[model samples]
Target: MATICISTVLNFRLRKPRGFCCSLSSHDKMKNNNKRETPELLKIAVSGITELLRIFSSSKDQRLDTVTYTQKDQPLVSGIEDIVDILQSDYENAYFLTGNFTSSIYAEDCSFEDPTIKFRGKDLYARNLKLLVPFFDCPSLSLQQIQKVVSSDKSCVLATWKLRTYLKLPWRPLISIEGNTVYDLDDDFKIARHAESWNVSALEAVGQIFTPGT
Candidate 1:
């Protein structure tokens, strides 16, 4: 298990940005308020990886009850080209930041792994993304390259991306990470595994959380 030092960081809170517009209607404002209850939510958000690891282990059997879609609504693709298109579109729209990617493209038990943690089940993966949404301020993911590759009998979709996000810590640390993800497809073309390789070490990535923003 990887350990991160965050004892001093958890007391942080998120404040609305200066000159940020809030023009939501009454109903919309109520809904947004219901979605996030502050202070408590802030506590959960800033604990960061420790909280994520706990949730990853504890949520193994939980289903993604947040999403509902019938067969007609599923973005089921028959080939790598279609898969690539959907993925690119999702990244373009920053769906990954919002935890609303097209889940139909991934296997029900698809495995997800990065330098910090690893887990099985796409439902769990989605839940993890949803958990991190509270701390992702002005997040951006730039897709540099995406292509299909085959090596002997195995094939996968590899995508390189640059990610920059201002974590809602007290000092507002800016995390900039460049990484590539390998999506291994199953027989039916659904993603069986999603593995990420970062340009920095696990320690370095964690250290970014403590570095104060400029």
Candidate 2:
């Protein structure tokens, strides 16, 4: 449960109506009228503040029974559990490498970028993953950390991960890369953009030519 406290200050100014026979110029009278309107301005300000307090109070009541994640709950994101499940099954699921992600978790116009490629549209993204699947054996993606950010119109998930696999060369060296990925979700909560950063360069990855145990 969350609590909100609102403090309001009220300012009052009392003014008596001026006589029409006053000798002051029109400009002077206008200034006096403006001074008299301070109470009205304060009324508007108080109304706005009251409405804001009401809104906050209502929101707190509605969320009282719900569990909210604070900064202490690191690596938290809405719908992240499902996304993790999908990623964990990706190595064994041909559909994940093919087009399943397109209709399931990704927006049709999603964009994806990594060290080697940058592209938009779910179809092309799925195609790229399919093409890369054949060059690796026993690939695994493990999530090391996750963080969620909510904004006015969209939400994002940042994940630190490690990808482990053996390149299908004659030596079949075991290669492991630590990387981070940012996934942006659209209004419907489908992945709209995905970008990855790797700790090692592509050339460095290619240099791992010998099997680890050999």
Candidate 3:
């Protein structure tokens, strides 16, 4: 007499409670979905950046590509074109986080709590953060590479910005190209006065924040 195990039969359903089918492997899933690679704009950008930032050591006369901002003695992303794009581009429903805000800004070191970061800002706060990214721009040795200030790190300024409109008359808003909230480019000054909450304490904490436009 052959007996089928009831537990085994029931467990099959448990494996896929959603019934969405998990049998397909990650690679297989992409393949089945007909995933194809888009033109790698990053590589092209890297090459052009490398050309722009051929020299390093940080000097007023030095031909640098990237620039940095030091408001309270902290290293901020400031403005690396590619990096800006990186921060602006939308991710696959992701999260961008770091253990220490100090380290994240200064060291370029980050520990993304979420596997991916959808830079697209669905919230006002997120939009403001995107504007802040440019404030960190510094002269790069090569494209995204950081260029030390000839001697001391005092080449850029650290300022604050706002995501929404606040001007009494009219506020020129930046529209994200990809329809993502993160990539907004304003023709007029992007900084919103009241919306900005920058303070000496915040600047001091960040250390070496910059206010270039200031």
Q: Tens-digit lDDT track for model 2 on 1-214? A: 0101111111100112222112223224333333322234444554455345545544656542232322221223357555555544442343322323324566778876443333477655443343344455676666666666666655666555666666565655666666555667776667777765555534344345343424
Give me the runs in candidate 3 sitting further than 4 Å from their true place. Answer: 1-36, 40-50, 53-60, 63-68, 73-176, 179-214
Q: Which stretches of candidate 1 lie over 4 Å from their true place?
A: 1-72
Relative to the unseen true structure, what is the C-alpha lDDT of residue 53 in candidate 2, on a scale of 0 to 100?
50
lDDT of 3: 0.20
| Tens digit of per-residue lDDT, candidate 1, span 102-179 | 888989999765433445888766665655566677888889888776555556776677778877767778778765
Give per-residue CA lDDT, model 3, range 111-208, as digits (tens).
11101111121232222222222222221111111111111321211111211111111222211110011111222212111111111121121122
What TM-score against the true fold does each predicted structure earn? 0.69, 0.51, 0.19
lDDT on C-alpha atoms for all candidate structures: 0.59, 0.45, 0.20
Using TM-score as the measure, the top candidate is 1
TM-score, cand. 1 vs. native: 0.69
